[model samples]
Target: MNTVDALVQLSFQVQRILAEAGAEHDLSIVQLRLLGILRDRQPGMLELGQHLGLDKSSITGLVSRAEKRGLVERSPSPHDGRGVLVALTPAGRRLVEVGEAQINRRITELTKRLNATQRKQFTQLASVLVNT
Candidate 1:
């Protein structure tokens, strides 16, 4: 395959691994992403939507579902009373931790055929691609 096709296939494989990891916690990939983003900082709905590349309505629905699962909470944004902030609950934090571990394990397995030098080269190449 060409470089673009190879990259696309790799992306899909990575996404599938993440989806499986999320499923173990009864979370959709989007919900897992929400928890991942909220793990670090409590961002308002608008900011969350922007970071997730979701529209406001989509963000609302995603957050609502996560809220129902007790993985996240919505509260009045401290910076803007009219807006709402999305934060990971303790349960969400724990789930994300486990999900991340699973993902890491799965990805590592995918690279098991590579030697240490190839793995380091791959990591550096991926970092450059991501940063650029």
Candidate 2:
């Protein structure tokens, strides 16, 4: 495969690994992503939609579902009285922790064949790609 094809295939492979990890925790990939993003900071619905590249309705539905599952909660934004912020609940944090551990293990297993230098190079390249 060419470089682009190889990168695409690698992307799919990584996504599969993440999907499997998310499945174990009963989360869709988007839901897992939401949890991951919420891990750092709570953001208003509009901001969350922007960060997730989702529309307002989609963000509303996603947050609603997560809230129903007790994984997340929506609160009145202190800075914006009319706006709501979405944040992970304590249960959500625990789930994310476990899900992350599973993803790390799966990724390690996938890359186990790579030598130390190759792994380092791969990490650097991935970082560059992500940053760009």
Candidate 3:
């Protein structure tokens, strides 16, 4: 019907798909996002917060939880002594690889449900929404 309603429905569907797929990886969406961000290298807490649009407090809490689960670790930054670095462990990297595969599978399933024209339109609409 309306734009908001359509968006709400899409969000619900996306969340449901992600939740179902991500359950096997045992990661929250936020944690998954962080892993995606860290796929290449480690980042400091401030950089992570900025990238995630979260505050220092939120990042600290996430890092704390992740550390407790042995998913991540905090180390002294090679660039700066005062800054701390966040890096994924071997188990964390394995989890991320599995999660990425699962998430991609779910996304492919969602896309397959759309016709080519509808998929194109959805892509354009999503790009516009993100830019706005």
RMSD of 2: 1.2
lDDT of each: 0.90, 0.93, 0.86
Clashes per model (N, Cα, C within 3 A): 0, 0, 0
What TM-score fits each model? 0.90, 0.93, 0.80
lDDT of 3 by residue, 1-132 (tens): 998998899899888877776666677878777888888889999999998989999999988998998888899998998999999988888888888788788887878989999989989989998998
Worst 10 residues of 3 by lDDT: 18-27
- By lDDT, the better pick of 1 and 2 is 2
Instruction: Sort all candidates by lDDT, best to worst.
Output: 2, 1, 3
Worst 10 residues of 2 by lDDT: 18-27
**Per-residue lDDT for 8-97 in model 2, tens only?**
998899999988888888889999899999999999999999989999999999999999999999999999889999999999999989
The residue-level lDDT of candidate 3 at 17 comes to 78
The numbered model that scores best in lDDT is 2
Ranking by TM-score: 2, 1, 3
- Tens digit of lDDT per residue, candidate 1, span 1-132? 999999999999999998888888787888878888998999998899998999989999999999998889988876776988888889888888888889989999988999999999999999999998
* lDDT for residue 51 in candidate 2, whole number 0-100: 87
